[model samples]
Target: MKEYASILSKDGLKIATFSNHFRSEKGVMIITHGMGEHSMRYKEMADFYTNEGYTVISFDIRGHGLSEGKRGHTPGYEFLMDDIERVYAQVRADYPSLPIFLFGHSMGGNLVLNFLLRKPNNIRGAIVTGAYLKLGFEPPKWKIILAKLSSSIWPTLSQPTELELDALSRNKEVIRKYENDELVHDRITSAFFVNVHFAGQYAIDHANEIKSPLLVMHGMEDRLTSPTGSQDFASNSGDNVHLKMWNGLYHELHNEPEKQEIFNYEIEWMNKLLN
Candidate 1:
């Protein structure tokens, strides 16, 4: 496995990207990570894809990981999609002849879906895991109204402090590493949450317009985004969609113990599509 780093200039921001290539002669898989996390967490998956004769590329989206910007905040909902498009352009320029696949997880999944709705022809196919089509927390109607108001006045207002320990209790090692990692942002802003909620609804409203072949995956035991989001996406994405739900996996299927099985399934699916 080999790793490389590059910087992408998007919307006047220097975004950092980390990539792993297994075989120099194979297709490319571009990964987009979810909220609060960076691209480095995907090293294992990148290596796995590389070993399977694929070049894997992932970038730290603005406000996450080693990328430039405030942690957990976006200028607007569409800014993240712009970042994805810029990164895709960079990867495509380098490997113009290779088949390209987009893989996104969590908030990354939401971004991929939104991208597809707007630019369906950009990639060969896409895979979304633990996507947030609908959120678990159903804020009151008034709170939603207030959040929007607050965003304009105080876009950077800190949100409910996220407890990584509470969220990752099942994986003590991950929690330990996250707590010690300075790059990971544990706190979100009010505007970030507001934008995410809007994005979630927007994707749901336009899911059927997606034209790319899609593979959607979720863990049955996932408590974060809920498997319902994947279910909704798969059901509405028309005939070009495939759905897989792991019996005991959590939100991060790639980090689960059965990740190898899931990874193999995704690779096989993509291989079949490319062929």
Candidate 2:
């Protein structure tokens, strides 16, 4: 069954949420979408989890989707983190006894990792795919300097993300649908850019501090975010993190041609943990 809801952020932004609740549920999975996208994009993924008897919850971070906020702008990175915590608190209040897990893609992956690092929580496990730890290509020094300066002076200054649309998946249909999705955007604010760029590094540096199991996956052929970032995180994170680098896949592993295989792999991992 599909359900819609909203929650208030610490600063009073209305975060829109979507969920798929099943009659019998093994656990709750809260999904976080990447930058430039919203929660509804994951409805298909939610359906997959619900079919396996897992209740799924996904939300639009303040500025994106049906949520209320400036497009591609947030006051700070902490606000975004607080939004996730609010959703978690809500899920805990509603399903107190069930194990809760997090799934984040791209920029959402970055947020989930940072949450695990800085926030204290009892989530059973976390899955991060194509995390935006670092860009696939080196950013120009001039652009970096401009972004830092702009963020300090005009934090809300927005710019096109310049993301290569075609690199998101090998599926042309997926790319076409994404291009036509009105909710899908390519804008990023200066504050959002600088904060997330640094937060990725912070998560990597503090990887050893995570106590719960983490599954980090990245597509080897992904041109959007560097897979080396996932490798660095797993290498530093001790035995708690399991890193999977899938060959011939792009940024969105769950949307890839072999997505069923990827989804089943995720379900199997979660099942093992539950068992």
Candidate 3:
């Protein structure tokens, strides 16, 4: 069954969520969507997990989707992290005895990594897809200095447009739905970029402290996040990490042609952990 709801974040921003609960209720999986996208996009994934006897929970992050805030903007970088914590608390309260897993994609993957670093003992395990541990194209030192200086002076100044590929051209239907959806935000703010960089740094700093069972997946052909990022995370996260690389798949491995294979792998991996 599907249920729509909202939770008041610690900062008082109401975060919106959609849930699919299994009758058997083996456990719970909390999903966080990528940047510029809403949680509803994962209805298929949630259905799959629920059929596998798991309760699925997905929420739009603050400043994105139907959540209360400006589209793609947060007052502070920690706002999203705090909101995630609030959602986790709500899930824990609902399913106190069941195992909890956090699943994140792209920018959401980055947020999960940061969250784990900040609160390492919160969840049982985590799955991160297309996480940006590090960028493929590293800007020069001068450019980094300039962005930092400019951000300090003008936090809202329009930063360089990072929209490289025409994401919509590949899937017209998905793009059309996204563009027409009132909850989706296409424009990202400068403060968002600054917060992203800070979050990335925090993950790197505490990579070794992440002791939970972790699964990191990335597409070899992913243009948004480099494979090196996943590699770095797996390599530095001690020994309790599993890394999966899909050749020829783009950023969204779950939406690719071989999505069934990816889903099967995820199901098996999660089952192994849950059992």
Candidate 4:
């Protein structure tokens, strides 16, 4: 079922929160979305999980969606963490005893991995797709230095993400919808760039710190986030971390042609953890 709420973020921002709950829920999931996108794109995934008897909750990361903040901008990383924490707290209070899992895509995956280090011991497991632990492609070092400096002087300065939309998925219809989506935009702020860059590094440094059952999946062809990073994390991380790689898929696994196949794997992973 679709439900909505106004979440008061710790930094006093009004966040637009959305939830999809199944009648006979076996567990709950809190999803964090990628940068430059809102929470609405995950409605299909949320519905799928709900139908599978899981309640999924998510919010627009501060500046991106119906949330109250500057577009494509944030105060810092801690502020972003607080926004996710608010929804996490809400789910815990309401569900109380239900098993909870954390799910993330791209930038959201980076956030989920970071939170795992904080050791939210109550969570059952986590699922990450195309997470931004390391960029599949590298930007010029000069450009990176410029953006970092711009973040300090003009934190709200926005620039095109230059994301290759074609790399998202092979589904023509989904690509068409994404291209024409009003809420979807290419602008990303300097502050967001710096924060996520640092957050990505932090996730790698503390990969072994993740205690919860972890499943990290990435499309082998994803040009945004490196699949090798996911592989390395799973290889070096504690025994709980597992990695799944899709042969020909791109970054947006949920939007891919074989999404159901991928979903089946995710469900199986969750079920094992739930058991």
What is the TM-score (0 to 1) of candidate 3? Answer: 0.91
What shift in Å separates residue 272 of candidate 3 from its native position after superposition?
0.4
What TM-score would every model get versus the actual structure?
0.92, 0.98, 0.91, 0.96
Summarize candidate 3's per-residue lDDT along 1-275 as a digit string, tens digits: 27889999877788998888553457789999987788888887788888788899999988787888767776667788888888898889988888899999988999998888775445778999988666656668886777677667776665334544433224455556655777666666667767886677668667898888888999887777778888877877787789999887777777766777888999899889877
lDDT of 1 by residue, 210-253 (tens): 87889999888777777887787677768888899888777788
Model 3 misplaced stretches (Cα beyond 4 Å): 158-162, 165-180
Clashes per prediction? 0, 0, 0, 0
- Name the top lDDT candidate: 2
Model 4 TM-score (2 dp): 0.96
Q: Candidate 1: lDDT over CA atoms?
A: 0.80
For model 4 the local lDDT of residue 111 reads 89
Model 4 CA deviation exceeding 4 Å by range: 21-24, 119-121
Positional deviation of residue 179's Cα in model 1 after best superposition, in angstroms: 2.4
TM-score-sorted candidate list, best first: 2, 4, 1, 3
User: Which residues of candidate 1, in runs, are more than 4 Å off?
Assistant: 1-4, 8-10, 21-23, 160-169
Model 2 C-alpha lDDT per residue in residues 184-256, reported as the tens digit of each score: 8888899999999889989888899998889999999999999999999898898978999999999999889
RMSD of each: 2.0, 1.0, 2.3, 1.4
**Model 4: per-residue Cα lDDT at residue 112:** 90
